[model samples]
Target chain A: MNWEFILGRSLSSAIGSDAAVFALAAIGLNLHFGYTGLLNFGQVAFMALGAYGLSVTVATLGLSLWWGIPIGLALSVTLALLLGLPTLRLRADYLAIVTIAASEIVRFVARSVSMRGVTGGSFGLSGFADEFYAVNPIPGGSYGFGVVQFSARALWVIAVAWGLVAIISLMVYVLMHSPWGRVLRSIREDEDAARSLGKNVYSYKMQSLVLGGLFGTIGGFMYAISQQSVQPDTYSTPVTFYCYAIIILGGTARVLGPVLGSMIFWGLLSFTDTALRQAVGAGYIPTAIMDGTQVGQSRFVLLGLGLMLLMIFRPQGILGDRREIALDAH
Target chain B: MPTDTWVDGVTPEPGVAKPDPILVVDGVTRRFGGLKAVDVEHVEFQRGAITALIGPNGAGKTTFFNLLTGFDRPDAGTWTFDGRRMAGMAAHKVARIGMVRTFQLTKALSRLTVMENMKLGATKQKGESFARALLPPLWRKQERGIEDRAADLLARFKLDNKRDDFAGTLSGGQRKLLEMARALMVQPDIVMLDEPMAGVNPALTQSLLGHVKDLRTQGMSVLFVEHDMDVVRDISDWVVVMAEGKIISEGTPDHIGQDRKVIDAYLGASHDAPTTPEEEQRQLAEAEAALDAETAEREQLQP
Candidate 1:
């Protein structure tokens, strides 16, 4: 019921490690859907590959986390190429279907009992983040302001995660302004026109898929490091949907849209959770009207309604140009 | 006419053979089911000249353009650009070989800025590499160069102010101009335009014609499909007439305008009409009689 506690937690959640990870993943989605007009609904598959790649390498194979990181990124790139090589030359909707299915397949494979020896089955992998934490520069002690505090280890994770997000954001910004980026946007708008101009359209689409998947894998790595564990459930279809929501909320194709969107999305979820729980505990609403369990689920319902409204009123999200969002080209 | 003449004092030198033709199509046939949509036998596009391929709707003019430019595959035929066979090349590969084409329906990238659309035309340039993208200085310099070229094209097309605007925001005529300007950014060896004047405003038609003329003046070959007889008559140095799927007649614009087969084709005469054996024999005799009469008339007129 404490307002100060709720506000502090909400603000920190908006800018915390999870937000950074989601923002990075959404940036990759922005590249795929927002800029390239590729309906890649399997972004989480890349993330899972990254997480599993790192976890299996380090924990199961007894390798270092450093070797695992690059391996994860390489695997994501390979996945992108494998998915893009055949499908990009076909209908774009094929990509949407393949990606969604691929991510689910990845999840099932990771959680399958047959792979228990290597993947730990549903229990997932832990203690693989020790090497990462051992390199943290922050000293011991919790630090923050106004009831919002993070322990030294948490601060270190946040620092690295947010730093990666910032660097990737800057890279996306500069690339989008370059000639190659211009070609990508043009292909999104009119691929036939680009082809008439001598662009290798299929090659460009493949490159974009690989690049975006790499970014998604980076987000997966951060998510694993932040939580200090790697689990199949963490990279589910819902995770991809959450990235999509973040991109839509921020504004597709805008450089800072994903970051801002992730912050706002997580912040709102935290605020609603705290406020609803507090209101129910204080008996501000009758139990017959809304029970604690019911209140717990209403936040997502409200969020869904908000998303529908945003799509109806401003399909371009908060900052996107309407013309940029209106993709008439197949 | 001051130059050499064909039959009946028709000027031939102005539209006759040039030093070299930029594009040659030989026996290109495109069939849709049983119907041969394009059955071009032989056609030549003169180097450094603007040639118009004109026919009424459904006469396969667009289909012929599509086949030559790699938008559609030919069932049986071959095409050459500057001595290189281009029969089965993909559209983009054809473009990379210095041949580019516009669509009958404008295909401007709606989401991109006018400038960005123009930049896409320069994709074959060296700076589009991933490594170059990471190194700003190397690619930045190239990007500015492309931007400068795009800006110049925009100015030439009188679309300079709209460079920053999304291509979809432009009017139909403006989009057409943007498409043309984008093609020029590639500096193609030969540019094929499909219905460049279709749906374009009358005021803009003159500018479009001027641009076509300028392309020839700059030593670039042009092959355009047009329905506007007046524009085709004015700008086209040579004209090829298509009917059903074949080049029924080809010569100067004046010659094609008055060709009897062309008139029959445009008037919707049934090219596939069944002919009785007796009727075919009678027609052959009539054709012999006409040929004799035409030969005598031509000899008298020549003297």
Candidate 2:
């Protein structure tokens, strides 16, 4: 087992393009669940909308990628408003159910044969990222140290994706520090009390949902551009769950929780995969105990166990206060 | 023991009518199954005066407060605050109209800091809009002003030391103070408190009383429900007594304390009575006679 190679890849994956995307999505989730007490379990649906909206517009309809960006954002905002309109006024749990169901519906629609012409039906869409890459400022060849190198094109995507995440994170920090942000946290704490204080609770919740969805959509755009494709499978329920894991692992309400959690999650995942494959090849464990095929599934199992322990011991993630995590869902 | 004996004539005084009462509840009835939780008849809360709504357990004091504050809707009645009807309005709208209320149980935003809780109270600030919030100079100036106000309020409530601390970290008494201080951040014209002293420590009792008094001193009307007779007696400029969903008595603390009906209501006698057809007629007759007698008494006592 090459320890150096594993460590380098794991560390880079922890803070790489995928981490940036997940962190962005988790930031949106933090706004929905952490600040507004909204249980948005289908944030990936917004991501899918952004991805599909861009892919369909650019690849299928022959529109420019720049046009697709705004269209994708608009669709995401519209989806959020539609989901929040009827459900935000209801129970918090209802929002969770609706969001999860909505994401599944979106995934199904994307894969459905009825939309094959536009969505590429399960085969997915590619070639839409050319315009995005054409604007890349990086000159040529691979860069970075040891086995942790990335191509100029890959570096360009990582730079832009991470840059967007940082900008969005900064925006979120600013908003949360503002009086509106204070109202959002207050509503999460006690909506009735906030209402008694003249807050338009429903409006605030709607705004939070839309804003968070927009962030998730931005992550979707990055995910699409990085992969140079839009596939229905990419925006599955696990994607949302992964964002939740990142949020919980970092700290639900803390500004930096998602970013840190994403890095740790991807890092651990990469480390476990590398270590397990290396151990299998080295014959450290008998074939009866575990095989190469089973190693892929075991990482998630380990991650789940780790999460369970984290939740039991410290429900608030590493950076979050326990009191901050006890949401007034009622 | 009988319906006839229960009809003791007690007249209500039609004192000097102010220009306009801050809040008026007329025949508001909120029924829960067979029980009428609140059946408040005509009751007026004067502007800029501290009024205490006193009753024993299950006396409908909190229910009446809920109805007036838009937490719950009344089955049959109308309520007006500052010439605006607020009977069926949402709680947020009621608050927007300058009538905010605290809960019997503390409803502090636990996750939010003390300062954030106070800032939430100032929701109606013009800079809360998305466009306004995005502009630094515009929103920043408004935010700073709100923060200053919240800081001052925290100082007044003696919670300035814990401004940066989450509200959940505060003691029960401190949370109550934070709730009260947060309510004032909106600059409400009338503040309704439900059991402000219920869970407060004895040491903080005086401070809570002072805060309630300060509301009146600052020309804000107060309607509070309290189980502690001592607190009610000490802080209430006027007391309204409720029993079985009705405002049975209204007067100064001394007058209410001495009222036989008010005493019976508190002693739980009101709940023991039967609501038969014959008893209802008899009570109605007694009420008419009491109204006449009270009018006559007030006329005689007038200047």
Candidate 3:
């Protein structure tokens, strides 16, 4: 068992570019669920649209990479408005139902053979990330400290992804502390009360959806750029669920919650996977009881159990107020 | 500074419109399916006075309040506030034009701190703008001003000690006080309270009454719906009585208490005026025996 390799991989994942992507995505989810009390189960749809928007605009429409960025952002905002218009007036459960269904529909359409020309079907799309790397100023070489190392290309992507994360996090922090954030929190508590005070509840909800969706789109941009590819299966239901888990695990409604949550979640996930494989190889457990093939499945089971325990014991999470976790579905 | 003159008896009369009325309602009707929840024909509220709207259960008192505050739209009617047409306006728009209201069921924004809830009521807050919210310097001074104002209101309500506490943690009566304080934060010209004393403790009822009276003394007009007749008699400058979705009578509190129609609305149409003390006692005894028999039968059936 190579302990050095496992430890290095775990450490890298704890603060790596993937952590940045998940953190940004969870921040967006926090804005919806934590701040506005909007049950947006289709966050993955916004991400998918962002991923496809950029890839299709550049690869299929033959547009410049620069144009694809704004196109992706615009597409996400449009999608948010479309989702909000019909569902904002309905009960919160309706939004949850609509979002989950909408996300699945987006995934199915992306992978369908009929739209293969634009979506690239199940084979997915690649080769559109070269422009993103062309402007990288780093020289070709390996760079890092100790057991952790990364190629110049990987370093460039990580730098940009984490940089974007920091900027967006600061923006979220500032906005949440402002009066607009107070209104969002008020709506989460009771919309009728906010409405009575002359706050346009519907319009405020719509704004929250669009802003959070925009953050999800940025997360998508980081994800697609990091992978240098886009695939329908990559933006699945589990992705949104993971973002929800990250927010709850760290703390909902806290500024740095998603940042801390993503780091810890990815670190634990990777560490467990590595530990389980090592334990299996070293014959610590019998093959009849648990095989190497089941290592991936067992890790999630453990994670689910841990989450359940956390909810029972400390649903408010590390930094959240207990009052915030008692979500008013009305 | 108006005084209540107790009149022993007076005839039931329809509402009389006041001169220089601040709010004028004309034929506002709201129907909930087959039930006409509210059918107010004509009414006027005097400026800078506290008026009490009293009715029995299902008399459409609350529904009328909703229609006037724009919480619910009337099926047909027109109303004006301070010379502005306001029938079709939205609730928030109505609030922005200096009219604010509180719910019978207190809405204190439970998760928010008491001070934060108060700050939410302040109008023209610069930080409420998304673009301006991102720039702290633009709204920070105004935010501080709002906070100071909230502090003063909290002090006035004797809620300064709980300013940092979540609004949900407040006792029922304290939540009512918080709601009233929050409404005042809007600097509203007209404050509409729905059953402000309904669930308040007897101990806090006097304080609440004082606050309502203070609203009038501060030159703000108050329109409230209340079931407690004593509270109505104590604070109201004018009384409007409704029955079956119409204003059955409107006059001084003394006249409303003795109006034949008001009494009938409370006790049912079978009620008649007693001519002698012995006859009144005999009728009361008979009603008590009937009530006792009904209770005995209910108890026997329950077990």
Better of 1 and 3 by TM-score: 3
Q: What is candidate 2's CAPRI-style docking category based on DockQ?
A: acceptable
Chain A alone, model 1, TM-score?
0.96
Q: Report the C-alpha lDDT of model 3 over A112-181, residue by residue, as the tens digit.
A: 9998998999878988888999999999999988768988988998898888889988999999999999
Q: What's model 1's lDDT at A105?
A: 91
Which pairs clash (backbone N, Cα, C closer than 3 Å) in model 2?
Answer: B39-B245
Candidate 3 CAPRI classification by DockQ: medium
Worst 10-residue lDDT window for candidate 2 chain A reads A321-330
Best by the TM-score measure: 3
Ranking by TM-score: 3, 1, 2
Report the lDDT tens digits of candidate 3 across residue range B7-102.
223232564667557899999899999998888888888888888999999999989988888889999999999999998899889998999999
Model 3 ranges off by over 4 Å: A1-5, A323-330, B1-12, B271-303
Give one digit per residue, the lDDT tens place, for model 1 in A142-234: 999987899999999999989999999999998887777877887787688888898888988998999999999999888888887888887
User: What is the lDDT for B36 in model 1?
Assistant: 85
Off by over 4 Å in 2: A312-315, A322-330, B1-20, B33-35, B123-126, B268-303
What's the TM for model 3?
A: 0.94
**Which scores better on lDDT, 1 or 2?**
2
C-alpha lDDT of residue B59 in model 2: 85
True contacts kept of each: 0.80, 0.71, 0.78
